[model samples]
Target chain A: MKARLIIVVIVLALMMVVMLVPIPYLSKPRTHHITLDSQRYEYDPGRLEVHQGDTVIIDFTASDVVHGFYLEGYGIETRVEPGLTKRIEFVADKPGKFRFRCSVTCGSMHPFMIGELVVGPNTTLYRAAATMLIGIAGTLIYLWSFKGEQHE
Target chain B: MTKIDLLTAAPWLKPILRSRLFQPVLMLATLAFFVMVILTGLFGTPAGNRNFGIVFVWIVWWALLMIIMVPFMGRIWCTMCPIPAPGEWLQRRGIVKRTSGKLSTLRWRFPKRFRNMWLQNIGFLGVAIFSAIILTHPDVTAFVLLGFILTGIVLSILYENRVFCRYVCPVGGFIGLYSMMAPLEVRVKDPSVCVTHTPKDCIIGNEQGYGCPWMLYPGGMQRNTYCGMCMECVKTCTQNNIVINVRSIGSDLTVAKERRLDEAYKAFIMLGCAILYSAVLLGPWGWMKDWASMESVANWLIYAAGFLFINLVVLPGAFALTTGLTRRLSKQTLSTRELFTHYAYVLVPLGLAAWIAFSFGFALVNGSYALVVLSDPFGFGWDLFGTRDTAWQPVGTTLIPFLQTGILTAGLLFAINTAYKIAAQYSQTHRQAFIATLPVTGFMTMVTFILLGLYLG
Candidate 1:
């Protein structure tokens, strides 16, 4: 029982350390020119993936109706009209998934019209997944230690 | 492992629970909110963000239900639910005081075949398929709520005692299923006392209260699955045998004998819905939303067919295969079907966590809308509370991913524990149980990975 408790404590401490540690990224940052198309309730490129120091310049166009591009965590908002182009540029400094939603109510499902921008390295996802693996391993170890103790 | 009777722990609580006015007062309070929701839904602007009905029901009430009430208090919402209030009152013919010697109803017996959660499973699917529309349109929200109340009233007039909630209501089914995880349960202090007493006042009506309006006998009750916690049994128990005890959370999941396939299917459906809802609603896929919201009839038909298929067939088939592996690995003589039913209980905590994680994503982001809608309920520029013009601000955007990660991880740990405990019930040796738990652990781990991927990136 004492050993099992110690194992549990060690697993939890490992998870916390993994969660708090920052990962080193080796990819060189570059400027990327991307085109974003907007329709009634969707963005054409629904996801944008860029390195942490990359400069992202987007030429956003609305094909069907008027739409607003409000990117979370970046504080960038632009309005695109049909038959016109709206340019938005920002530095990919924040290294996490940020949602870009339609600020204007376009239709019934307008509130849910969303797109995602992922800035690498996505340390959060990696850490979470690693923590989950550690948790399961710890649990199995703890349960395996309970052999012959059930009848005690 | 330890039972603390809340009635004994807090003596002041017993009288409040036993009062005839308690349930009614709660019902009336929520009824007032219900009426406001309906009225605002009918008369309010088409913008769901500015409407009281949409913000309150989907954001505020949903957060409360998923995050707090269901986890901690069990079916306490059922105790105060206003949907069945009018029907029950009409049957009793009075509100504050008990006036009916017999309930005014036709007393038609609900068919025995329809007693399980099959109807609720189907009904929830029926509503869920149209959630994109029902969630956004205030008029549609109003109509659906109206439909629920009307069905409740019609059922109440035709039968006796909360048949609507027990068998037919869509929301009530999952609440009852997940209520198993709640720490609080209303049960008998001593079954021998109930047996020795002749009147069985908990089952039959006495002057103090109507008999268990959920139509369950308090003495024979073992799980929190169908007990609505209306406190009627508390009021009517002649020997003071009924007690609301605070027991260990998820204790009912270990009761292997009461496991049934219908409930197993419910767990599958809930987990499947949570996954699909996250992908469709929160995922960066507009075409999926277009199909779900019924931009075209053909697209919606395709989406609905796929939705039903994944929920009813694909998810369950996968889990059944996992359970089959568990049975074979453990060398258990128990049938695969039995193992499947018993092991589905493991999904309750993870399913709930998936829902909470999903809710935190939107409800907190959209929660500020509740305040705006409260002041200007109809969105006609009526500032009743003088705070109608509050701007839209998404709270805790930086903290949400961490919260989601923690919740999903905790849920996975709980699910693994539950899986081991359930496996132990079928195994003679601890090694056998550990072997049996591996396959299910792998399945749950995969599910957690999927949810984490969606939330994180």
Candidate 2:
């Protein structure tokens, strides 16, 4: 039982370390100019990726109707009408995944019109994946620690 | 450890359960909201975000159901669900005050072959296929809800109690499946007391309450899957044998004898739908959303076919291979079919967690609309609650990834633990059990990775 307890402590400590310790990235920040197309219920280039200190310059256009872009965690909001190009620029300092949604009540599916912006390296996803693996392994070892006693 | 009966733990609960006004009052209260939801769906704005039906039913109610009610309270929602209330009240000939007579129904028996969850599985899939439309279109939501109530009434007229809920309600299917993992359960406190009691009043209604509306005998009920937690048995148990207990979660998943293929399929369908819904609604996939939203009939047809194939064939076929590998590794004596059904129990917690995580993705983001819609239910610019001008804001956006990670990790761990317990049930030795669990654990781990990829990738 003491050995099992020690194993559990070791596994949990390892998981915490993997989750909390930040990893260094070598990619230098750069600027990217992109045209983001907006339509009825979706966005062109629905996914955006950039380095942690990169500058993102978007020439946003709405095709079929009026649309609004609101990026979570960045506090960037813009409105674009048909035949008009809205320019928005921002620095990607927060390094994680954030969702950009249609702010205007466009149509029946307006609430779900969503896109993602990832500022790499996406350490959260990696850490989460690793945590899942370690958690599963720890659970299996704990389950195996029991003698062949009938549970019922 | 022995379970804590809530009635014994808190003596006040028994009186509340035994009151004839209990279920009816709860149903009437929710029925008011149900009526408003349908009314708004029929006459509200076409934009889903500004509409009460879309915001309340899909975001607010679904969040509460997935995150709170199903996990903590078992089938407590069924006790207060207003869909079958009108039909049941008509059958009983009164509401709140019990009527002293046989229920006015045709009393035709439900078909024996259809007694299980197969119809519900099919019904849920049918609704799920058109969910993108039904969820967005107010009129469609209203019509679907109307269809459910009408079917309940018709079933009540044709058959005995709650055949629609027990056999056909689409939402009830997954709710019942996941309710097995809830800490709450309705059970008989003592088998000896039930056995010695004469004239089981719980089955035959006394003046206090009607018989089990879920068509379950409290004496024989071993799981929360079918027991609706309606408290009827509590009202009518002369020996007071029936008690609502707060036990450890997932206790029913180990009831190996009650496992069934139909329920196993329900697990797969729910998990598949959660993943697909996350990818389509929450993921950055425009074409997938277009297909799901029925951009064209042909596109929709392709989407429907693919959806059904994945839910019915791909997920189950993969799990079957995992079970086969477990059987081969452990040399367990059980047949492959039995192993498949037994092993499917692990998915209950994982599927519920996936849904909770998926709900968090959209629910918190859109939940602000609930306030706006409450003030302007019809979106006709009438600010009844003085909050119509409130701006749309996504809540808890930063916390979502962390929440999803914690939930999915917990689910994967629980699923692996369940896999080991199930393997132990069939294996002669602990080593063999651990070996048998590895394959299924690997499958669940892969599923967790896919879900995490969708949520965080």
Candidate 3:
């Protein structure tokens, strides 16, 4: 019983310590500028040009039902419900133009909920293409590993 | 035999469709596919926001289990379990290539003194902490399914028996703990037959196959803790000694002497989990968002610790303190542990009812997603069923939600009544005639109604 108690206490203490320990770098803030009632978004400057050290905040909202603001490559995602404003922040440490899209299952035209983030020096279009290529490669690899030998 | 009797008698009537191994593999593959789907649906396309299919699967299946299945069949979910199948397959593969006698025996004996209901309690905590995120998010559905698949495979290969199902599976733990209040049970027809039999086929499998995977001795089985209703024991018993019996609701609680410390501990854990699940899932907090946003390792660690604190520290601690307080008040020199073990039995029904109430709304709303399976089994289009295109609107206007809330309230009252009865029996006090059970019961009843309203409206 004593040993068990000691173990529990130690485990809890370690957890507390880890939880309190802060990450070294400040989280970069990415702005997702959006309009709620209008169901539209205007990324201030509609396109962003940022260096690797900078952060961007996507300050956004939805006009109708809840719309999720999600960027695939950088792993930044959050919900933008109607009548509510949401800001998703992320670092542009990686020099790449990532595609941002709405995640929430919206209406019929939800399939066209696509947007692009331009990163680096006037190479945003190039970065977007590269990111798309990487996504394609990742998909192919996953299919190769998981799919049955019949495909081979 | 009558229809009811025939159904009861042939409990193992259905042939195990997929090998225990297949379920886990399929679950893993399905989870992986869903993760990819979430990523693509969220990131790859413009109209990706409508993938409620995965979320529907996670919430509806579990809701069905808690509401209808666990109360009726007693942990049969652990039998057709998809989580541990991969691990068992790995174990089988390893064992097949080796000489049967050459391998070192791998059975580890559970220490008699150390055995406690901590695991069950911990399991409930685990489920409660994650319930908010798991119930709400479509993306996290993949993760939860993957978690089960990983757990199933890992435990099956490592342990001699289904340790994941018995000791670790959060859902299994909850079902086993609260299922004490359930009326139906599988038990031996004759104790004498069990006593006379030299080799217990129920515990150790005969030429037929592996016996009770949870290691329950059926002759002494009184409660729903260890039985997975695998029916291997039923099949192996030479005398045909086992039968599924229907009895009074709280029959298991009346037999106090047979209660184990682990079981008593599990009851408290189930209660704590019930409260915590209600707070996190139904309560208006940003708990769901935090759970999703937290890094995976950190999220899981927090959940594990929270589980330990609530199940192991808080609930048991409270129950023990209450028993101690009662003893002092009554001037009775009863052992605190003994008193606690007896009183804790009442909380089982409360936990069961709370689980039912909490899950009822989600099941009703999200169960419509199952139809999507017919249209797109392999993610291909097949509109012939017409079920695939249908989006679930709640069955009736406000009527269904109101009816559900009433049913939930009734269930909670039943739980409190069961608790009060046990308390009266143990304390031997004048049934405090005016002592209102209504305040707490009423609060929970209101909470259930409000949650249903929010979910539906």
Candidate 4:
């Protein structure tokens, strides 16, 4: 009985270890190739979504005047002049949405030049959207079910 | 200004707010800036970011108007607005004081049919259609401002007492609509006092001040929709009846008798514009931007048609359908038109919120440009404040999405609350009210999602 109890304790400890450990490398690493265009304070394919353990290869071009790609969270910023392509590769280690904005001063709308690099599963946006949907559902249910104020 | 009974909470504030010089003083200060805007637009650098006119008007003043003036001060900007200043002075034949003997004008009666916000709506739509040109081109911006002043003058000649601002002036229309949500209001301290007092000095000029320039009687006004906050009534009131009261936000939305189709359409147009502005200006669609920027005359025509259609048809149609569904499902018996008009108030808070969110995108990032522009108002290499060389720095870029999300969410909730309240006001029972709000709730959620997709996508 004591030996069985010891075996159970060891198994439980091992299970906790498995649960807590982050085996990101074990999951798999894949590379994603994306082409992005920056023009007049906007980006083509403004959203880039990838998994946590994927490599992201971005081929960027500025169709208009000089523009930029300043990726937050990864500290990779590039200045792409018009008619030139800049290639950038980075590991998708972070599983969240990070904005890639124009680093170079573009034009009047330059400051607004921004795009999104979303590493999946982008649970934050999903959760926010879910919460909004839930709010609607909850409001409907509350209104439909609850009896209103009695006029005095 | 009617229905007020409370005492002056801030007696010290009275003298400051009521002084005859106060509003004019404010106007002069802003007029100086306005002059600079015109000058910069005429002669400044061609670059919009570097130009004082674009930076100040679109980026700086717009930010203040959204975040501060409309939310806190109500028609305070109207009090100091430079658009109608030249026309008004020409009408009164003076800059500061009331001038006796029939005011200068052609004294033409403003057409009654055109008194509503319809003209303002058309004017705003006209401006918004060419927003890309007007927003970016300093020359265009100058011409637009000049056009407003010219219109104001022409109307002053044809009519009396700020007829342009009241019946026309697209900016005034927007301000008046949003002013309903402001916490501050200028109202009579007691309606009885105004009634008991003879001559109705507040409505007709006295030695102290001119009559209400916006053509509102201080004793009968209820909502903060039309009072331009000129404080002319305050100066003219011998009974000291006028008092600016600080109250809860959105108290004016509950004023049911004041609701109308014109205002409802204004709500739709504003909301549609906000949504479209977010999508076209901030969204990832380059072709859409191209269309708005007038890349081609055909594309612009298509864009303009689409713009007007979305605003006039798509949004209102969807809302009417929602209201209809709500009534059908809830088994409530009410006029469909009235319901449509009533529920339009739900969009007020949400519209402002959407605008605030949309403004946050460029305003935060481009706000820093104002510094450089100010030092060099004409961008003629004149750094007056020693900040013209201030580097272009986008402040708070990282937090923009979160801000947009939070604001949109708040706006959604506020809209839901407003819908429920309107329902309650219309219905006989709370249950019926809740049922009425259900469809509205769904509709509000959808609108919020559309905004979120534009901002967060």
Candidate 5:
């Protein structure tokens, strides 16, 4: 019984740690360079992670047809054609995960053409993770408690 | 199997339900919208968010189906589905009421081997594999819709009584699975009444209405998995025994004998698909999106293999392991196969919640685009409603994470509760039951965590 209790605590602690670990965002804004390559329907390095107060410079190039890179929440959207590079510069003032998708109709699977820009101090992700852990914990506690109360 | 009759409470709904014109009329109206969506698909703007077909079908109608219809009303959409309407009308040889003459086609029996959910499962996977294309491109969407209608018509001509819907429609597969949780059901008022009542008009049909289109015997129907809610059973019952009931959600989940491997696999596939969809469509996984969208034939093949393997083998394998553990831990005398199948039902609520949660990510993000598309359906620069140029604004963008967390939490709770209840079935001792539930709960919790990482990470 003692071993089981210890195991349970360890499991809860590990889960809580995964769900509640804080991200350290740089206080000062720094300029970062990112190269994004687009093929039939995807962007290379599909995820770009940065601190909240960073300046992002992205060199977007298309390997095939004309593709539009429309970033949600950042108000930065551009069209990059084959053999031509579209350079965009924007400040990462936000702290969340935002999708940057192909706005142009490239082909059959054009609408699903998407990428992500994740800025740090991403609290919602942590909140959501914590909520899920809590959900599991809450339900288990209730079921166990209910069973105990019934004395069956 | 226990149900409370809605007719006993409302009483007046019987007339509306009995009227043969009601269902077809609703079908006709939806048909207009359906045709309009198809037309827009063929001649609309190339941009998906701006086009009516993609917006309305994927975002609007999809949202309604996941968040409302399937959750609240069992097989309600099947009652007035436009895909099977024209063929069904032609088969009956009339639009509104039952016609006197024979149906206008060759009526052959659908093969017995293909009658199971296996075909529907395959059909759903076939469409799901190309979902990035089907859910996006207007031409593809239009063609898919047209294909379904034509298939329905051809099946109606070749076979008898909605073989297309009962055994073929891809959408019906998931809807049928989740519709088990819906509060609304059409069942016999008393099974005794139908058992003794010989020469059943509900099965053979009378002048009042046609035989069951969904190919279900209303008498022994304990679950809403197959019943299409067409009211044909209600209309044709000479003894007036068929009654629609407003009962508790998921009352069918506990039905033991009605469970099947096909339906259980469907639960796994749906849950897996929901997780994968969240990752590819809503997650930060671009390479996965590329592979899923068939960026190349090779990449697509790999993605398809992984997708199938995960859905068919991985999820089920993991679940079977968990169920096996539960059985072992409980010291139960029941067969492991029975326990596995029954435990799979626990994922139904979780799957439904996952789909709804995953939907909110895109549905809310792109939901506002529906308004713009509605105003300019054809996208020929026509602003019929003057809202054509509505800017791309994601509704509830800030609230999505919270909403998702809350929804996921609710789903987990339901699943855990279901797990405990299922464990209770095999275990006589409360201690044994609690021991049985522990591993499954852990597995479910881990599943929720994966969803969290996908949606919230």
Candidate 6:
């Protein structure tokens, strides 16, 4: 029984540590506004075009019921609520047309709630340098946090 | 031997094929093929993905369960389950090691008082509640793989027998319960063989290896409650007593003369979970989606707790309370607690039947993904069938979903019948009480169908 308890505690602790410790990373800021509802996603354009080395910031809200924003290839997901804005920022390192869709069940047109992101070549060297520095700093901070623990 | 003997012995003639080792190998091969299909469909050409869904439903889901899980070796799916492979690897590598061995020393002490199936009941409901998202989304396959790896890791570190299988696995509980209706079972050829043998190798592992990983003492096993049919016991027994035999359907449905309190509580919990799962999976309430997608940590926590309370605490509590009141009105001697505990075993079959119904629908929809690899097993289009250019349709076709619903309904009716039989076997007066509960069951089933329709529609 005691072994079970110890195991449970250890597992819980590991999960907590993994969840709480955010990795340090840097990327350029690029803002995007999107409105979603059961029927459709209202954005500046259906296609989000950005350069490779830029941070794509999606500031999104739902116009109707709640809709979940999911980018399949990147493993990024966030929920967009009506009248409430949610922010998601990620680095566009890969050059490709990545698809995004609404994960939450909305209505009859839920399956058609799809969007895409097009990444092109890096336009600014300064932005790339800054992002690299931030990424390095983030990595150092993450390592520092776990350094005190005994590594087996 | 007489013709009757030959007829009975016909099933035994295929002994080598039906052997425990053979079954596990067959199951593993089938799983491998299924995995390969899934990988191909996900990465294969558009043509491959389209036909994958069809083959998954017609072949893998129906054929595997009917031909393998149910008939060949009941609940054996839980034994060779690949879901926990990743988890086991992680645990074995000491990626997640325990700091204190405090819990290890006290592991042998089994708590005499606390064995309620509330956890099992709640676990099933939790899985069912998520079935909407899980079944429809293509990403669930990855999630399933991740879950298996995590479970494997946990089990590798734990010393207990089938700890992951018994308490943690949602599918295991479903199979263990529903398999009560499956005709195949591992049994002792002679009761005397079990009794006369000293230091029973069946229960305790011999030189060959470990004993029953599911931890069932074959002597006391009344039903398939915990048997994984790993057949470790069959091989261990020096007496060569254990025989895989066929029996009447629903043989395990008979109520025990005396029931333990925990076992009884488990029955009620199981019943409640079945109702809760049916409602969440098949009910039409859009609020459920909102509840699942709630962004606030506090709100999500509350929703989860509320769900647990409904399935684990409130439903069983209410049923047990009602049973107690009925006993009181009939001028019976049993207390409410005692009555609740005593009648708990009756719900096992009912719960299992509901699971089978739900699983059948899911399997039908997703099992076809297994055959998507026929044209391109290695993502290399051999074009063996030439019909590869067909556009893949999303699962949840009108006809397939409709058929699935009907199958689920049939399973629900079977469960209700099992519940009625169990009640009749237990208390004479309670037989009417059990029949009275049919309306409630019907209401829940209706709610489930509506929910499923909404999700599928």
Q: What DockQ do you compute for every candidate structure?
A: 0.70, 0.73, 0.03, 0.23, 0.36, 0.01
Q: 3 or 4: which has the higher DockQ?
A: 4
Residue B149, model 1: Cα distance from true site in angstroms = 0.5
Worst lDDT run of 10 residues, candidate 1 chain B, spans B389-398
Quote the lDDT for B171 in model 6: 60
Error of 2 at B208 (Å): 1.3
Chain A TM-score (model 5): 0.75
Stretches of candidate 2 exceeding 4 Å from the true structure: A148-152
**Quality of candidate 1 docking, DockQ:** 0.70
The reply for model 3, stretches above 4 Å from the true place, is: A1-152, B1-53, B89-105, B108-116, B131-140, B258-280, B283-325, B328-333, B373-388, B424-457
Fnat measured on candidate 6: 0.00
> Distance (Å) between predicted and true CA of B50, model 3?
5.0
In candidate 6, which residue ranges exceed 4 Å CA deviation?
A: A1-152, B1-8, B11-24, B27-73, B83-144, B207-210, B257-287, B293-303, B342-346, B356-389, B392-457
lDDT (tens digit, per residue) of candidate 5 on B218-335:
9999899998899988789989888888888887887877888888988988999899888877765667776777768999999888889999998888988988888887887777
TM-score of each: 0.97, 0.98, 0.60, 0.90, 0.87, 0.56
Off by over 4 Å in 4: A1-29, A39-42, A72-76, A83-99, A103-114, A133-148, B1-7
Error at A3, model 1, angstroms:
2.0
Candidate with better DockQ, 2 vs 6: 2
Provide the overall lDDT of each model, using Cα atoms, as 2-decimal numbers: 0.90, 0.90, 0.53, 0.81, 0.82, 0.50
Give one digit per residue, the lDDT tens place, for model 6 in B269-344: 5555545544443333334444543435566567678766875677676666656655664444556666565445
Candidate 5 positional error at B412, Å: 1.7
- Please state the error at residue B176 of candidate 5 in Å: 0.4
In candidate 1, clashing pairs total 0
Q: What's the candidate order when arranged by decreasing DockQ? A: 2, 1, 5, 4, 3, 6
Q: CA lDDT of B7 in candidate 1? A: 96
TM-score of chain B of 3: 0.73
Question: Per-residue lDDT of B1-457 in model 2, one digit per residue for the tens?
Answer: 5799889999998999899889889999999999998999998888888889888999999999999999999888999999998899889889888789898999998989999999999999999999999999988999999999999999999987889899999988899999998999999988778777768888887988888888888888899999888898998888878888889888898888899999999999999999999988888888888898999999999999999999999999999999999999899999998999999999999999999999999998888898899899989998988999999888888889999998888877888888888888888888888898999988998898999999888
